[model samples]
Target chain A: MIWLTWRQHRKQALFTLIALAVVAAVMVPTGLAMHHRYERSGLAACLADLGDAQMIRQSEAAVHCQALSHQFQQQYSDLAFVAILFVILPVFVGLFFGAPLVAREVEQGTHRLVWTQSVSRRRWALTKFGLVGGVTVVLAVLYAVGVSWWFGPLVTASSGRMGYLSFDVQGVAPVGYTLFAVALGVFAGTLWRKVLPAMGAALVGFAAVRLTVETLARPRYMSPKTLTFSPQSVLRPNPATGDWVYGQGVRDAAGHLVASGAQIGPCAPPGCGGVAAGSYNWQLYQPGSRFWEFQAIETGIFLALTVLLVALAIRRLRDIA
Target chain B: MTTNDQGAHTMELALETGALGKRYGRAWALRDCSLHLPAGRVAALVGPNGAGKTTLLHLAVGLLRPDAGQVRVFGRDPRDDTSVLAEIGFVAQDTPLYRDFTAVDLIRMGGKLNRRWDAPLARDRLASLGIPPDRPVGRLSGGQRAQVALALALAKRPRLLLLDEPIASLDPLARREFMQALMGAVAESGTTVLLSSHLLADLERACDYLIVLQTARVQLVGAVDDLLAQHRTLVGPRSTDTGTPRGVVSVVRARHTDRQSTLLVRRDDDAVIDPAWIEHDVTLEDLVLAYLAEADTRATRTAWEVTA
Candidate 1:
């Protein structure tokens, strides 16, 4: 069964490996260059000292670091698009490899040949799904590692890792996403039984699920922690820690949360003209320390959905005739 | 039960069905089709288009589930047991082969999927047919592709082979060649075969047992020679008025001209004949066509009665 799976899908597997190799070839040199620049410019030390009051007070050091950060950001800014492409990579896997896995066989009437063999339909489906899905996950993990390593310097210097774009493409999320997408493709293929239509439906279905999870489900996994500070403090989240700031607002002395960008005059007490004495602004955020927790939660969701879809696909095979 | 050459009593039927049926949405593709084909016979399932021939064959191979009843191959439900599946080989209606796979790849796939795959026989058959093993199946001609499908099915070395319209699309020469190779395989292996074809001439040439299906029902099932002997065409004057013969199974067809009446009847015995009537032997083709035509007229009459 393993040999049969390999023989049938070696083309897809080879192309995927070559594509990953190409990505590695392009990223390795560029990543090394970025690391060399980070070391030479001393931006690492500057970033490390960003929390020091004296470093911020030193205008010359601040200016130099800002210039270095700008250069690094400019050089690696294209990686943001690459991250977006990485986000769509699983959809491509679902569309091309996953969709055609069963749909093409059905459309060409070859399932009659394969399913009627000594291998039972359930076994055949399982072998194909397991083998292809396992390979997809491995490739996705490799891609995640490569992209994360290539963008490590940029992430440390400019954008912290907890942002939307970085959160998804790094760590174990991409593997989960790939698995979910492949399962979605198989389910769609089983339902549609036509290759192109199955691919289209899988693409649309994957996008909907991904977007719903990212926008609606992921944030509510844990109630965000809130921190209150005087209005004199910076209005933005702490840049040193890459916490995902959900929202910020001001609260009056009575502890009622006020709309953001509201007139502070109503709540400002005596001697609070320059900085509000009574009204304090609060930050609602998921902290960077919970990155692994979030990854585990999101990956679990995708994997559970993947298992459901695979089970559905297998069950549906019995009714195919 | 019958004793084989080894003196072992055997009651195993190659295929059997009881009230078997299948439906596609509101329409029944096959309905209440019960049949039995004993082992070691070349049986042909003859039907018109949409007459449920393919449905019956698919059911026997467990490619399809029956909606109403059961299909048993080799004395057990083919769908429920892996052992039953292992003993039966099937080539579906379209002769579907993976277009991208080379002949060798298909053989390799067979070897991987089947426990009793005969790799050497497959390779040798392709070689003897002058089919290049390395060429992708898509590049092969239709006839060659059909041959490859046959080779794959034969290489499984199953006790029963089910072919659904295996040669429907082939030219006459290719059809003869395919049947010849199939017959040769059957002779060597003593395999039971259930083949479906709409071409009566093909069935006449290759099949000893005949099953005629029409309108999703079994119209006739018997050995070819027995069916021919049981059905006789009687020609007489229109006024003879042989209302209904005794010991008749069914009046298959009746036509009356100005002064002559022709009737095809299924009878149990060699009854005494009317002196004025001439009895002629029925060919397999004529017998099948008569049954199909009779079935169609009966269906139409039933529809008319319902409307009335």
Candidate 2:
């Protein structure tokens, strides 16, 4: 069974490696260029003080190179390209790997032969799940390593901001999500017993779940907190309700201070006038906080959901007409 | 013809159905289809379009579940018995070979997937048929594909072979050749076979036992020679009298030609043919048709009786 599974997945496995190579081929040069630019721009030294850069130099060239590196960090923080790759890989996996896994057999009526063989339906399903699911995890991990390498210089540059939700998260989420999608594809193929419909259902279904997570779940982690304080040169109490208004300014209709004060939210939503406290605005948020925790929790949740979907798929295969 | 203990032991039947039935929603594909095929005999399931012959074969091979009753292959439930399945080879209708695999690949697949496969036999058969192993199964002509499918089935070295319209898509000459090869293989291996076919002539050539189906029911089933012996057609004038003789198993059809009465009847020895009518020997084909016609009349009469 394992050999059969390996034979079945060998093509997709090669395709994945080739695709990853292409992505790396393009991103590697861009990454190296950015690293050179940031080091030349002194941004490398600036961030290097916060992190590590074994290749640091203090010349004009190094400062400009460092600036390019910093710029790359700032510009690609969203990891938009990598995120799109991650978001889309699962659909392709489901279409190429999951849909054909069962639908072809059912359509061609070869499943009858398989079912009647010495292998039971449960064993067949288990073998497929173990083999394909193992491949998905391995592929996901490989993708993570490749993208992580491309983002290596920047992640080290950004210090901690690059860890939980930056390009790393976007790039790695696809791996996890594709695992989920493959499971979904199996379920759809087994239930529908056809390829096109199964592909559509798996793609649409996974996309919906991903979109929902991105919208409602992701923002909670991305939103920054703000805290405010006023100097003794202006510190005073509020006349109304006797609440101490530290910055000695009139409160606005929206309950904000009329002037500069502490603001604790993800970077004051454009046009809001305020100064946040507890660390200079220029300083990056401290890493290893609730942010990393959220990422760990979210990943665990997605992986669990993927397992559940795959279990349902296995059950469906056993009872398929 | 052996006396007591001197006789050879009779082998157990390879397949047995007890009132087996299958239905697709309101339509009964097969109903009360009971049969028994002992080891080392070739039985042909003969029926017209939509006669549930394929349904019966599917049930017996465990590819389908019966709506009622049971199917046993070699004394074990067809669907639940892995040991039985390991010994049964089936060539489904249309010969669903993998389109992507070469003939060699498919043959190798059979060897790898099946526990009892004979790879040497498969290769030798393909070589004999001039189907080079390297050619993709999809590239082969329909006749070649059928031969490949037959090789795969045979290479399993199965004790029982079940085929559903195995030669339905082949040309006439190819069909004959395939049948000949199949008969040769069966004769050499002594494998029991149950194949469904609409071609009565082909079935006549290959089958020693016959199971005829019509209108979702088994109309007649017995050894081909036995059925021919038991049934005869009588023709005279159209029976103006509605009453049928007591021993008449059935009146196959009624026709009026120039005031002469003709009746095709299945009867016991007690049902004497009228001296005015002519009694003729019935071929197996004639016997099958008479049974089908008799079934149709019975169905129509029952429907009217219920309505009345």
Candidate 3:
């Protein structure tokens, strides 16, 4: 059975190999260009000057200013590239492992022969799913490791903040997301009983969920803002007066008051409460706590959902007769 | 397994159906299709289109479950026993072979699936039949594919071979060749064969036992020679006895001719010699036709009476 499966997937395996080779081929030249730019002079000088900012602030002398170099841009691009790599990982995994796995069998009607053989339908479904599912997980993990390695230098330089930029290996979110999407593709394929339609459904579904999460869910994940304000003569003013607003120029048209932004003020009417609350630039409060906690919890959630969908797929295969 | 005080010739039976029946919704496809085929003999299952020939074959092969009664292959219930399937080689109608596989690949799959595979015999037979094994099955002509399918089934060395229209699509020459190959296989292996076909000529050439079905019922089942010798169509005048006639097995069909009565009876001796009537010998085709015609008439006119 294992040999038969391998033989059946030979074409898919070849396609995956070609795709990976292309990616590796493109990445090598890109990596070389990046290495070259980082070693050049202008970019090198920017890093050298970044540390000198503290030194120059205290001295008050017009020091020789160094420009940010090509190396900095290269590093920035490298950091951004990691996210792009992972966003498309699920698509590749779905194409190779999920698309034809069950749908092809049902479409070809070869499943009837297998179903009527000595093996029970449940065992048959489980064997195929287990074999393919194990391979998919392993491949996903390998891809995650590759993404981490290829962008490790850039990520560490930018700290975990690279995650906010899209492709950072900050938490377990990427792994969970890819596994969920691949399993969802398999479920769709099984339900649809055809290859092209199932692939289309998976693509549309993945895109919709991703867009919704990025646009709608992001605001709830964290609210970031920037604010600048001076301290009082004796002590700090009320913290509520410095509400951290998330976006730029968020004040209403007449500019009477800012509807969004974090601020603190007294509750009285027109007294010390509204003492022209010293104007300040507001930055939304960043979620500093529970990062790993959320990662672990959401990882479990997505993985559990994946297992459930796969179980449904297996159960449905029994009635294919 | 001997019985009382009789020197009757007995043979080991290959297949038996005891009041077998199947129904789909309101219609019955096979009702009380009881039959028996002794081992090492070929049985031809004959019926017109829409008759229960294929349904009976499917029931016998365990591919279909009977709604009532039972079907036994080699004295074992086919539904519950995979052992029965192992002993039977079934060639389904239209030859369902994997298109991507070559003849060699099909035989290899058969070898893996069946416990007893005569690989050498299959290869040699293909060679003798002038069939190329390396070509894909889809590329082969219908006749060639049928031959390949036959080889696959025969390689199993089954005790009983059940075929459904094994040569319906073949040209006359290919059909003859297929029958010749099947006959050679059976003669060499002593395999019991049961085939259902609408083509009477092919059945005439290859089969020894006969079963005729009409309107989802078995009209007649017996040895070919015995059936031919016992059944006769007797035509006479109206002054004839209507009850069971002398030297008669059964009154299969009877009708009143112009001032005469024609009776089709299953009797070996000369048709009843009444000076007032005329008797004639019955051909196998005429004998089978009379039963079919009678069965059709009975089905249409037999109405159920409702009681208050």
Candidate 4:
């Protein structure tokens, strides 16, 4: 069964490997060059120790770091296609590889051939999903590693890892995304029993789920930490730490939440504050230290979805007759 | 094995269905279709275009579960028993083959999936048929693809081989060639075969046991010789009050001319002959068409009665 699955899917697997190798070919040299430039300009040590405040205080050092960061961003900008590709890679996998897995068999009328073999339908489905889904997860991890390496300097310098784009392309979350996309494709193929429609359904479903998770579910994984500070204070959430600030609001001395940009006075009616200094601005954020925790939660959600879709696909096979 | 009084062992049944039924939405594809095919006999499943032949064959191979009652192969419910799968080989109607795969690739796939796959036999069969191993199945002719499908099933060494309209789409020459290869394999392995086809002429030379299905029901099931021998066409004078003969199982069809009547009847037992009537042996084609025609008349009559 394993051999059969491999034979059936080796073409797609080989294509995926070549695509990854091409990505690596483009990313490796540029990544090394960026690292070299960072080292030569001494921005690595400067950014590592001085932190955001010290860097901001020393204008000369800040200027040099800013110039190096600009150079890094400009050089990396040419590889924007890679980022866009990473974002859509799972959809491609679902369309080309996963959607056609079962749908093609059914469309070509070969399900009857394979389903009648000595192996049961459940084993057949499991072996196909296990081998193909396993390869997809591995490739996605490799891609995540490659992108993380290539963009490591930018992420460190700008504290951009917690944003939507970087978060989707880094760490173990991409692996979960790939698994979920593949499972969705398989489920759609089994349900629709046609290749083109299955591919369309998978793409739409993956996009919907991804958008929902990013917008609605991800920030709420853990209750964000809130911090309040007076307007004159220099204390702000450090971007260098990759903390995600969800929202900010102004609050009066009585702790009533007020709209940002509203007037604040010390002694006034309930709707207004007489003194601006008496009010504080509070920011809701997820700290950079919770990156892994968020990754775990997001990955868990996707993997759970993967399991459910795969199980549904297998159960659907029982009724194929 | 139990023995009869004649000292011959009672034949084991390769497939048996009791009140088996299948439904696609509201309409039944097969209903109360009970049949028995004794082991080692090549049984022909004859039916019209939508007459449940494919459904019955699918049910036997465990590709389909019966909506009601059960289908048993070798005395076990095929849908519930994993062991039963190894004993049955099926070639579905379309003769589906992976168009992207080479002949050898399909054979290798078979070897990987079937525990008892006979790789050498598959290779030898393909070679003898002049099929190149490395050629993709898509490039092969319809006859060649059918041969490859048959070889794959035959190499499984299954005890029962179920073929659902295996030659329906082939040309006359290709059909003959496919059947020839199939019979060669069956003869060598002594496999019990259940082959479905709407073409009655194709079954005349290939099948020993005959099953006729129509209106989602088993219209007739018997040995070919017994079925032909038991059905007689009687010619007699036309009479409105003519009663059915005592020994007749059923009146299959009746045709009336101005002066005479011709009736086809299934005989239950040989009885004293009515001197006025003439009896003639029925051919396999005539018997099958009679049953199919009878089923259609009965269906239309029921529809008319309901409206009236």
- Each prediction's fraction of true contacts recovered: 0.72, 0.31, 0.00, 0.81
Q: lDDT by residue for model 2 over B117-138, one digit each (tens)?
A: 7889989988988887887787
Tell me the TM-score of chain B in each candidate. Answer: 0.93, 0.89, 0.89, 0.94
lDDT of 3 by residue, A1-321 (tens): 554455456666788678778867766676555555554634334334334221123111122212232235454664475567667777667655776677766666555333333334555566666777776767667666666555543443332322454332435666766777777777877889888887887777767766665456554654453333222222222221212224432232334446454433223344333334553323334332334544565567668867887888776664343
Q: Which residue window of length 10 is worst by lDDT in model 1 chain A?
A: A262-271
Q: For each model, chain A TM-score?
A: 0.87, 0.69, 0.68, 0.86
lDDT by candidate, in order shown: 0.83, 0.69, 0.66, 0.83
Give the winner by TM-score: 3 or 4.
4
Name the 10 consecutive residues with the lowest summed lDDT in model 4 chain B.
B1-10
Per-candidate TM-scores read 0.92, 0.80, 0.65, 0.91
What are the clash counts of all predictions, listed in order?
A: 0, 35, 22, 6
> What would the per-residue lDDT of candidate 4 be over residues B1-308, giving only the tens digit for each residue?
11221221267889988899999999999999877788989989999999998899889988888899898899998884668988998999889988889999999998888889998999999999999899889999988999999999998999999998999999999999999998988998899999999999987898998999998999998788777878898888895554686667777888899999888987766574466778888989989998999898888888788531
lDDT of 3 by residue, B179-211 (tens): 998998899889999998886778886788889
Identify the runs in model 1 with alpha carbons over 4 angstroms from their true place.
Answer: A50-71, A233-237, A255-277, B1-11, B239-242, B273-276, B301-308
lDDT of 2 at B79: 77
* Weakest ten-residue segment in model 2 chain A by summed lDDT: A237-246
Give the Å shift of residue B225 in candidate 3. 3.2
Q: How much does each candidate deviate from the true structure in C-alpha RMSD?
A: 3.7, 7.6, 8.3, 4.1
Tens digit of per-residue lDDT, candidate 1, span B1-308: 11221221254688989999999998999999888888888999998899999889888988888899999897899884668888998999879998889999999999988888899999999999999999999999888999999999999999999999999999999999999999999999989999998888886887888899999999998777777878888787785454665555566888899988888887656466555667889888878889999888888888788531
